[model samples]
Target: MSKQAVALTLTDLNADTPCCPPIAQRRIPAESAAVLAPAFKALGDPVRLQLMSMIASAPDGEICVCDLTPAFELSGPTISHHLKTLRDAGLVDSDRRGTWVYYRARPTIMRQLAALLTVEAT
Candidate 1:
């Protein structure tokens, strides 16, 4: 990863290129790696990754906790813990409505994560 690899731009994700020149092309910057590592960490778990995908791909842009809990075989508290992990990572947002809690995806961070992982034409 070189300095250039660390300096991500919107066009990197938009144009005909991968995100960066590739870790092989240069050295990865500590700052860029630090900012992106958490996102990868958050997704390292199968449960959390599934939860993130579920929330991100939700039909109405959000899903209820009740809905999420029943979809998994894990206990309620365990699911809650995973959801909390995502929330703390700035990946999801939750809110209560009546008796149910609903969660929505945070697209900004998702986009940022996608951009950081991109490779370039070079």
Candidate 2:
């Protein structure tokens, strides 16, 4: 029997093109929902949510894992797992420099999420 290799690719959250119209404006298509649901699920965890805020608000547009670990009581590995979840969700990107790994928010995805949630005053 031959085994088939499945390749998985993440949606480019940083693309210039918008993923879809705002959720308030129209119903989201299944493909867009499939791509975005994981990102929302990743943020459903409080720790991951805070981590996302920190990475997004970092002055230099990125922050180191070493710096992020000290802010939480969780162990380094636990924090890393959460970061990995964010990475897989296409909400953030990471770079390793020596012993430290830095994370940067993908602003395009953030903007898309914000737009979807925005409710104009009637």
Candidate 3:
């Protein structure tokens, strides 16, 4: 990926139109691939994938780090590291509240990802 590709962001993709069609429909553009790669990489990990699902499905549309940690056998810092990766990938957003950090999925990026994976029925 070129440095130029690195500059593309999830927000750079239009909400009404995805940067590219479903990967099954055709090849993903270099720019779109670059923009989406980080998110795909972040979710490539089982732990992070699970974390994302939990955060995305939370009843309040957000979840606390405290609540997340108890579901896994890993150490707190390990979970925090995974959460940081998701945030860095723009897949999630975080807010510090007292001792716990709250996390919520970024719906725009989530939609972009979902669109890319969507395969229309033939």
Candidate 4:
């Protein structure tokens, strides 16, 4: 048996770009799935999922690492690791300000993920 390797290219998950009509509306392409699976995988963890919600729901559209760290019992490094996972998955972005780092949700990817899971009532 021969195995064929698929070349993976980064797919822009920008909010302005329409990723797909809808998961229910049409079939998702394999390439698109390859690009998007990582995001879902990143959120598979309970800690990461809660972190995403916090960042997304932050009043100022961003939250400081200090604010985020205290919310969980985990240590600073554990929280930072989760934040890094989110950043790597393109679900969030962080900026360093003074002595603190702030994280903000990427609306484009959030919208895309929401749309993918949206199911119209029949």
lDDT of each: 0.76, 0.82, 0.87, 0.85
lDDT of 1 by residue, 11-58 (tens): 333345444444555676675566556667889999999999899999
Candidate 2: residue 108 lDDT (0-100): 85
Summarize candidate 3's per-residue lDDT along 19-39 as a digit string, tens digits: 678999998777777688888
TM accuracy, model 4: 0.86
Model 2: how far residue 26 lies from native, Å = 1.0
TM match of model 2 to true structure = 0.86
Q: Name the runs in model 4 displaced over 4 angstroms.
A: 1-11
The Cα RMSD of model 4 versus the native structure comes to: 4.2
Question: Model 1: which residue pairs collide?
Answer: 1-26, 1-27, 1-28, 2-27, 18-118, 18-119, 18-120, 19-118, 19-119, 20-118
Candidate 4 has its poorest 10 consecutive residues by lDDT at: 1-10
Q: Highest lDDT: which candidate?
A: 3
lDDT of 3 at 86: 93
- For all predicted structures, in order, the TM-scores are 0.75, 0.86, 0.87, 0.86
Model 3 lDDT-worst window of ten: 5-14
The clash count for each model shown is 10, 0, 0, 0
* lDDT preference between candidates 2 and 3, better one: 3
Q: Name the lDDT of candidate 2.
A: 0.82
- Candidate numbers, best TM-score first, in rank order: 3, 4, 2, 1
